[model samples]
Target chain A: MNNTDIKRITPKNITDKEFFYGHKACAGCGGSIAVRLALKVLGERTFAVLPAGCMSAVGFIFPQMAFVNNAIISTFPGSASMASGVSVGARALGLKDYKTVVFAGDGGTADIGLQALSGAIDRNEDIIYVCYDNEAYMNTGIQKSGLTPFGTKTTTTPAGKNIHGAQSFKKNMFEIMAAHEIAYAATASIGYPQDYIDKINRAKHTKGTSFIHVYASCPTGWGIPTETTVQIAKEAVDSGLFYLAEYQNRKFKLNKNPKSFFSAKDYLLKQARFKHLTDDDINIIEQQRDEKWEYMREHWK
Target chain B: MSNKKLFISGDEAVAIGTKLSRPNVISAYPITPQTVTVERLSEMVESGELKAEYMHVESEHSAMSAAMGVSAVGARAFTATSSQGLLYMAEGLHYASGGRYPIVMMNANRSLALPWSIYGDQRDSLSLLDSGWIQVYVEDAQEALDMIIQAYKIAENKDVLTPFMINLDGFVLTHTYELVEIPEQEKVDEFLPPFQTPNKMSFEEPKNLAFSTTPADNLEYKYQQNRAMFNSINVINDVDKEFGDKFERYYGGMVQEYRCDDAEVVMLTLGSITGTVRMIVDKLRDEGKKVGLLKIRYMRPFPEKEIIKLAKNVKAIGVVEKDISFGYEGTVFTNVNSALSKIDNAPLSLNFLCGMGGRDVSKSDIYNMFISLFNAVKGEKQKRVQFINMGVETDE
Candidate 1:
């Protein structure tokens, strides 16, 4: 859907009052949209803890938060821990009633904040830890992150005559978190609003730690058009590049069927981040997606 | 039952103490001194000796994090690490304390960063003093065991919902096996109550957790954490006294003074190094040096009143430390200076950085250090800090 039809599907039930609106986000930031949808699904019972990332900087201003309930703490790489503390403290005081949530970017989740995140999960800190994966550290002027997919050009991983974008592939954080044997962990995208909301609802009911990694598109960082944010995000999952799955009781289940898939080129061509790729490069990307798809299907099934 | 006894190392005793408390989960990563505690726990889980989920994480950071997760779910949890492993999980430590997950951890005190060595030093635990944890330093294997059990009681107390770290010196306590009275699980159950978190994720009571802290709520939450820590001071004494009365092991108060009555000189120490000071004090007493040793038990809420009270009658005080503060002085020395500042005409607080990077702090080192401190007091030429008999390397 284009900009004209956006209002129709934007969830009529959601109030126009942005829980964290009127803020500074690069005109079509996926983090902003995802946060909007997340708060929409979770409702006012939710409390948000964000670290030093784009959302922490722009999403919610002081005294006036985008969320309705409560907004507390800002410690880079410690959002999950802080959330865990609030939840645990509430529980200790017989106030076991509110949702405690942590919102972090890929840099905070996959890199620096990995330890604290791991600890919260290990402790089964009964909180929702959301990682809005926009590939790079967009708030820090587009530096590379462990979540940055290979061949995605950034300031650090410059696209040039000899140099490739990123040396390593995007670290599969969803699978890594699942390895901790947490009760609930799944992948979602701003592209599929219904599916994303359904997953958050599912996590709300699940006991122990719940992790949701949202594939958020960055119009400024990825050099994509402001309007096609959802379209690009959907194509990433539809192309089987980013699989949607859940892990519980040491078992994996694919939340979204990958049978009807599109070519990686459909997802790649639309974004400016992959504009430098040639036909041969697209083939390599398609090949990697297929291998990963087969590997996940093998283990998941 | 009154004289229950068993052969145990400091780490093993701590493991036994943890098992007695019946932690629902135990996550652990290996490190020297701290390794044995978790290793024994691993064996317990493997052999069905303990009925709990033992998460063997890839790293210390994950281990502590997992323990926090377990505790968040309204389950009692425990984890242990030492030195580099403790430093690696430093961020997680603050999370546990701040999150108010009463996770009990043990640190086998070892040296800090730079040219890494796995020897006894207080730097690892001391560095984490400001991380909002109820930190208690144990001097012997028995105290280590008793304190581990007490840590849970104090930390999980309704009035003080904070995590705690029981610090014990490596080698001196961890390596040297001793006779520790193994208490019955039934008795432990009666002494330590079950955990009940207020807002847990349950089918009957669903709730959101670890939510974001707004700027206004942030200050109040921090203030609450600090207030909880200060309140824990009284709770520590109560728990320790109650347990000591039941088990005949006295370790409730923060600092324990040894022969400070009418003493002219006072030497301060912590963890297993106190053994050396005990011998030094005995030797100095025979030689009429009027010297005594003040062992710091609870290092975090810092025993401010007790420290000032202990040093009130003394002429000069020397703080022998196993860790350096870097760019300034020793951590214990800094704490002593601050604590003593409150007293009227307090003793001279002399700082000494010694036995770093796992180097042994022998009786000779303590004796000589105390002698120099005594001489400094008599000659009225007191060097604020002494490097002690640390291995020296001078180059042209």
Candidate 2:
């Protein structure tokens, strides 16, 4: 769906009612923004399971919760399993209308929490597991995560003499979720609020297991100014670094593909995580980005 | 009340007890020794014999996590695991008890890996003594079956909302077949009412559960949890007594004492090994040796008063354990001594660590341990801790 189409379908009466607010997140934390927007779509009658991540640490600040709906802070790698239990318990209790959602970070989702995630989806658990990907382990102070891009400077992957930064490409989480053959798997960005809301709404209404991988920016971790968080996310998508798409019923559909993709070097230069990249590193990154873009264009219907 | 007997393993007995209790959710991952319990539960769920949601999780961690989820929604939930699986679910054990979910889990006691043995041992559950779970070690298939039913009531008691671990020896109890009297479902339904809780996850109130707490308020929550654990001792006795009155059976409330009134020597044990200890006590009694046996049923609410009372009358006591606390004596021995230390004149005690990795704790081994206890009572010099039948040569 295009931006205009998304806006046209968006609910005008959608409450700017912030279900989560006044927490300890950074000034322009993309993860909390995505959670706020997603909870707005999910509405009430929703129980959220937050793992040991930014959301759990900030949203649940001991005796002072920011969430309006029922929420729990489960163990680091148990969000999916906890959500599965909540969904099954709700059904067993004859409260099947209640929605169980898992709000986890990239470190919790792609690395420590992947096994439980796969198990829940494979069981076709009736829950929505949303991975707010900030590229690295931002809550733990910019440590390297599986979703960290190649040549990005995280705490573990510092730009030293011999090694530039991270040496691996970002893990394809959407592809992994799609492989589970879940009822719904989609990618959304905080920059595209309307598109993100639409995907969350669709996921909420859909049955079976639904996974939404949201590209959330971390200004503190990326060494960028807090005011440009949304701008950086938009540039990441427009520059072909991050793709927005949905996979359902064994069919792949591009959600919002840019008419003319910007240069990957420009996107990398916008954040300090990739500021140390050399000319050769940028060329390799740009080539890999274009190849991935071409592959998505050819494959995504 | 028809007391129909069924020839089955302790694993099957646990399944029967769970079926009778009518749990709302059963989540478990298959592990050795404990695998049969979940297998039977799954079959019951599939065959429509048990109406419940069975979640086949990826690991023991998820199993316990799911069980907590179910319990948080005012449903009785159950799960089973052993050895490494128990260690894997160790993190969730604290959560279940701390969150006051009242989940019931059966842990087929097995040895921890390293040398890698799936044999019967108490190391798994004994090592997790401080995880805030009310642990009950059963002696035979019958107690295993009955305690599984009693565990739910004890855990779900409003005064004691703690999770319980019903431990049965790996091969001895889990694999051995015996004629166990499976209670009728209606009797169990009358015994355990439907779980009712105001602390569950709800849409009407929308309260945060299992939330993060600062140090300022964290200790108070733990104090409440500890208070609940202390309260469970009374609840356990009441439930066991009520269960006995209904089912015409009693496992002697927490610590089962046999012939200990005027005995000079008493042997303390847990799990399946208690049977062999009791047999040794009978043989010793026949030989005119004033020997007795104290089978510990519940370990968490340590039965400190009962232990002190039992030991105060005896001249000497020996604690037989399948686990060692490494550097310290056996965990049970340590707890018993801790309880005894409070008394002015406690009995002379010794620790016998046997059956590690299921090395047989034969009848001869029990006789030898008794001999050591008798000798210690006579003021003979002896090692405070002994590894029974370890086959290792010690330069004494």
Candidate 3:
């Protein structure tokens, strides 16, 4: 998209809202940026339930919180369940103006917390569940997570002579959520702030359970320069390794498609975590990426 | 309005109590023995007899997490579980108590799995004594209903913001039917006010809850929780007294003493087993055996002061419990001994682990326990800890 098109799509009131400022997030932290943009769309009457993750550790540091609104820090796998309670309780107490939202990580969504997340969505609870996927468990020092893509090096998935990095592909949480037949499911990236904010706003307006999977880049874990965090996330989508899409009413639509898609090798070569990949490994990754894009194209069309 | 008497099981009585309490949210997962309680609650919600959000959670962990969320929003919340289900919720239990959410939950005390027994036992609730919750054991259906109603008042007290667990023995009190008095809704409403607290998540004056604390601040928060737990003793007594005065039914404060006045041998018990012991005590009293009964009502506050005062004059005290603390003695026996240790001239105590895995503690078993306590009071050396009715040969 051109600069004018981007400007036209972006919300005019985007400003330096300090609701989530003074957090302990690392430099060029895309997770914190996603949280900031999400709160902007949710506005002031939003109540949040944060599970054990980078957001829970950084945003809520006892007696001093970065959130202007109330936020309940939950157990590692309890964000969705707690949000269900908060939403129901708020309605029971006759508070209709406030919104209940859950901010969790990939591990807290697809792995340890999947059951609770599934329970909440199946009940069609009135809450917005947002997962900022940094691929690995960044808060616990970059361990492998189910959302971690194949052939990515994490502490647990160290590239060794006998074994490659994470052997399994990312657990397609967006598809899983869509399979639940929820009212809304979408994927966004920090590189596309306008798309991220717009999807979040759309989720906030939707009545039932709404889930947004955000591809938030972690420069510290991904072994990239702090300044290149957004660029890396953009490259991920542009390379077709990650796709921006939405699901509603049993229909899927692609939100952004690069005019000339880059190769998965180009995206992997930029990050040190994938530096151990050989030509054969890169070939497999490229094939998998192409298959995913083809799948999305078929579904979107 | 006059109270109505109905024949119901302990689980049904608990459902009635919860209905009268008017919780705004009840999240539960079905477990054996506790299933009927949740089932009855679901029926109430479905039939519009109780207006609440009943969340059929996927697991006990989610049930507790949801209860905490409901309570954090300044609305009354409830849940029920048993055995492994309670163990599954252990992590969230600490979170609920640490966050100081006044959630009231019911625990149908069942044996923990290993050998895999589903019958009644106190091991589940007894093992969680240090999880920072107010634990109460009821002897019958009537007390189960009444105490559950009072639990909300004690838990939601501004001075004592802690979760409460109303424990009734699985298959014993939970499945056994008895006559229980259902109090009028207006009276219950008058006794227990609508939940209102500043510790909730409010959009008007937003504040952080359950925030992460560093080592420097964590200790103070725990100390504050301890203070609240200690304060709950007074709140429990006050609420019990208020409930008694209003409903014309009273359960003795902390430890209910029956005919301990000039008795030389007093037996301490908890849960439904207390009822059988009460019968034995009455029969022994008729025979002029000088026996009495002390039913422990609240386990968390420990009732150390009351137990010490009661045991000081007795020659021997016997603690009969269904739970053993593994390498140690029965948990109730341990607490009673710890309390007695505070007194310089404390009475000699014996631990009688009975009715484990729902093994029936017949009248003869209660008679045998009393005989041992009587013999100990007469300076006859008896075993300090005896596993009553284990159906195995032992050196007597």
lDDT (0-100) at residue A22 of candidate 1?
Answer: 66
Highest lDDT, which number?
3
**What is the full ranking by DockQ, best candidate first?**
3, 2, 1
Considering summed lDDT, which 10 consecutive residues are worst modelled in model 1 chain A?
A: A1-10
Ten residues in a row with the worst lDDT in model 2 chain B? B67-76
lDDT of 2 by residue, A158-249 (tens): 99889999999989999999988989999989988877888888788778999999999999998889999998888888888888899898
Off by over 4 Å in 3: A1-9, B394-396
Tens-digit lDDT track of model 1 for B328-380: 89988898899888888987778877888777667787777887787777786
lDDT of 2 by residue, B39-120 (tens): 9999999999999999989998998888877877778889999999999989999888889889999999999988899998
Could you give the interface RMSD of each candidate, to one decimal?
Answer: 7.2, 1.0, 0.8
- Per-residue lDDT tens digits for candidate 1, residues A1-301, read 0123233223655556556576678888899888877776666666677778998777455444444445554457556765665565445435555677788999999998898788778778778988999999999999899999878889999878786677678998998998898888989998987778767777766678899999999999998889988988998899988877777778887877767688787687777778787787777777888888788778887
The C-alpha TM-scores of every prediction are: 0.77, 0.98, 0.97
Candidate 1 displacement at residue B77 in angstroms: 1.6
lDDT of 3: 0.91
Every candidate's CA RMSD? 6.6, 1.8, 2.3
Q: What is the lDDT of residue A210 in candidate 1?
A: 93
| Candidate 3 structure quality by residue, lDDT tens digits, B246-271 | 99988986889999999899999999
List candidate 2 stretches off by more than 4 Å. Answer: A1-11
